[model samples]
Target: MRRITLWLMSTVAAVVLLFSYRTSTMGATAPDTPGVVGAAPGVVPGGPAPGPSAGSSAPPGSTVVNGTVSQTRWGPVQVRVTISGGRITDVVALQVPSGNRRDREINSNAVPALRDAVLRAQSADFDSVSGATVTSDGYRRSLQAALDAAHFGS
Candidate 1:
């Protein structure tokens, strides 16, 4: 009887510890920040990059965009979004850190809203993602940065 009781208790303890560790790790979020651009860092703290040349082949209204989306706990997430003639041409998730489950969850939750925002975007103004506000905001900022780059040829 005594041996059985000890074994049960040990099992319970192990299960609790495992559960705690998993949850704790899963709860962490990534950071939000600007990233490198065209062989140069994209998110320079001071300001944006220089515009494209006048003779460049890119269409007059077409834009090429690139930036990063990061969560608070983890590293940054690099993203690229292109807009042309006031419409979203592409949305890309570039670089996301590994091991942070929350970041993935946040991304999953925000994807729909992000898509809507891109589709409905007018002058880079759009709503935030529902469940993952921070992640959504980060993504939005990055998208906006990319849009700016595309429009202004930065």
Candidate 2:
């Protein structure tokens, strides 16, 4: 019985040590190079790329949109907005860890206000969502981020 228990313990210890070493090694290596294992056959890594024409009209449409919103104890609120062609096409709740309770309220009250605001202002400076101040602020910030990216590249 003693011999069996000792053998089992030794095996478990060895396995744990091996797993730890493997995990450490895994963290040490760099991730796969950009154009190596799964890269396209002909494309070379770090190759020079073509430049856009000076006359290009801002790609003619929306290319991509992303946003992040953080939640607070006051409410589950965050904002993400997507725009194309100098217009807001979509708005998302980026950081609302909480359910849509307050979010819904904000959306209901703030969306129309926001749409009006967007239409009126040169940029995405919408009013806060009614009853959901934090969410409203987050949404506005997100919209601003998207609009800023659209207008200024930064």
Candidate 3:
């Protein structure tokens, strides 16, 4: 009886502890900061490269546009696209969720893939990263917005 009781108590305590643990996703709210479309102030080592400044002039037939901020459950996602000669020449993620280690890891893997896919497909209708669905969705939304802002492909 004593052994069983001790085991039961330990199990109950473990369960309680597990239930009380907080995750980065719990009760989090998206930030209100608007996305910056120009040469960002600082660059994340493993994150997207900075695009040209909004005030800078694109080549005669090229255009640069910043996507709207997309609020995901983890955080906001945004991108900037440069279209040259009527094709998507480059893509830069202006903002991506980096609230925690996991966010950073997921995006570090996902953002580059998304950017490459956009450049190849020349649109936002591309396959999302396997383990980063949320981030991918936000990326697509922002990419589409940027394309629209630039009047790309239409």
Candidate 4:
């Protein structure tokens, strides 16, 4: 009886936490806080969609490079980096770990956060997404590859 009571209490607590979080975040109503769930400064939606641009030509004053594809448990993670004026101009996710609706949702939320962090830090050393550590690591590695290819210093 005591074990059952404890288990039931724990379940109830977990449910409460879940709903509270959902209620707080479901609407995306929070103000833009950059490097969080909101868009980063100078970032465009679907920014520079990632792709293979290695050895390919980009417009003068700007260059695009593709990162290595990182395979995660859910799927693969890949990205592209844009460089101009010796600085990182943008990041775009070409491929993400998406094998199901849950995967899609998780990646969807994580990618933006990762991008924002990368742009802000101008490096691969950014905070991992709250619920997407695997994807985050893959993204960091892939982003680093693109930066290396571009010979980016910062």
Q: Report, for every candidate in turn, its global Cα lDDT versus the true structure.
A: 0.54, 0.44, 0.74, 0.68
Overall local distance difference test of candidate 4: 0.68
- At residue 35, candidate 4 shows an lDDT of 27
What digit string (tens of lDDT, one per residue) describes model 1 on residues 39-132? 2224222222222221333344555555644444444555655556666755655544334666666676567567667666644467776766
Weakest 10 consecutive residues of candidate 2 by summed lDDT: 36-45
Arrange candidates by lDDT, highest first: which order? Answer: 3, 4, 1, 2
RMSD for each of the candidates: 8.8, 13.3, 8.2, 12.1
Q: Residue by residue across 50-70, what tens digits does model 4's lDDT show?
A: 233324444466767777777
Better of 2 and 3 by lDDT: 3
What TM-score would every model get versus the actual structure? 0.51, 0.42, 0.68, 0.62
Query: Quick one: best TM-score, which candidate?
Result: 3
Predicted structure 3: lDDT: 0.74
Runs off by more than 4 Å, candidate 1 = 1-62, 68-74, 96-98, 152-154
Model 3, TM vs. native: 0.68
Q: Give the TM-score of candidate 1.
A: 0.51
Q: Clashing residue pairs in candidate 3, if any?
A: none
| Residue-level lDDT tens digits of model 2 in 46-96 | 222112111322233443333333235333333334455655544443333
> What's the residue-level lDDT of 8 in candidate 3?
100
lDDT of 2 at 34: 32
Q: Model 3 shows how many backbone clashes?
A: 0
